[model samples]
Target: MSANAQMVAKYKNNFLKEVQEQVEMGEWVKMCMQCGVCSGSCPTNFHPGWEHPPQEIFMMIRAGKREEVLTSPSMWMCTSCYNCIVRCPRKLPITHIMHGLANYAHRLGMAPKMQPTRHFAKLFWNNCVKTGRVNELKLSMGLYFKDGFGQGIKNGMAMKDVALGLLKAKRLNPFEMLGGHKCKDQNGIHAMLKKARELEEKRKAIKAAA
Candidate 1:
């Protein structure tokens, strides 16, 4: 069976339980009281892409709408402004839960494929993790070229003035395209990240077993 299928069977299709056990800080999802305060407080509340706000997401989880919740682009829309968390009467860690849901959906390969936020997040994470530092130039190029060469050229041209300004300010380095500066202790950084991944996997395994 596919990993997702196996997980579905293992969880007996109980998406809420799966989320609670698998997602970061997901156990707190039950604390939501459906007051709509979180939805109202969101800065992106006016955004049409927000198909379901925080409280609605929690409600969907409780209602067992697994596919709808996981595949929706709503979670990816969070900007992590934390307005929902601050205004929530239950004091729920709403920001963490939203990100947790997004991460969980990504891991299961269930997130919307074309979601811009998810795409940018993947690009940013890969760019930074490689050298333990961000190569801003390469990151920007990657984003520009994500659609196609034609679109990428257009994007670059459109941002040419901004790029030139950055170059003049010494903020953008063209040489970074070749190889940019990296962390001094590259091996140490890689080792530390590897160890962290191992610990995280072990923790998840224990949670799954429990």
Candidate 2:
């Protein structure tokens, strides 16, 4: 058998199972026609570092390359320009699928080690969820210090000029970092986020029980 056929046969159960899971995760990916339009429209596909564009990612998903797909850097490269979606003959939500796959990978604890974007995204989300606003200084500190204090200092030094510029422009506050800034309706923000999380958990439970 050909290599493609061999892989499918070797992991037939996983292939079928993950295909069904992904179809349920992002329904539109199930309709991918392998037309390659999505990857062709994707500017990142030309970048040497980008290994799996939308079409290739879907194919990998179908082929049961679960670990590779989850660890792929390409998922984080989507620019959300919607070029693929606009051009897709199948009308697939290609951009959404990319984001979905990234989230799915992170949720499964399969994201590649030292994925800076993933770390940054989690830090950003946590800050936003806590205050209903992104405290730039806190977010930056969190991201930089995530690896450790030493790395944080190094990162801060690297961005010294940009940080100074922001400070000069009054875009960031040192005092807020210490005193902590918060939304006026902190209670309302907490309530809304709690409700959203509860709903998300409910959805996950339903999916798990299915």
**lDDT of every model, 2 decimals:** 0.87, 0.77
- lDDT per residue for candidate 2 within 1-210, as digits (tens), equals 899986665444465355345433465666788999988898767875577888888887777676677778888777789898999999988887788788877777777657666677788789888877788888888988887899989999999999899989998788986676777898899998889879867776665467
lDDT tens readout by residue for model 1, 69-155? 999999999999988888999999999999989998999999999989899989989988888888888888899998899999999
Q: Best candidate, lDDT-wise?
A: 1
**RMSD of each predicted structure:** 4.1, 4.2
TM-score of each: 0.87, 0.77
- Report the Cα lDDT for candidate 1: 0.87
lDDT of 1 at 207: 83
Regions of model 2 farther than 4 Å from truth: 1-25, 47-49, 201-210
Worst 10 contiguous positions by lDDT, candidate 1: 6-15
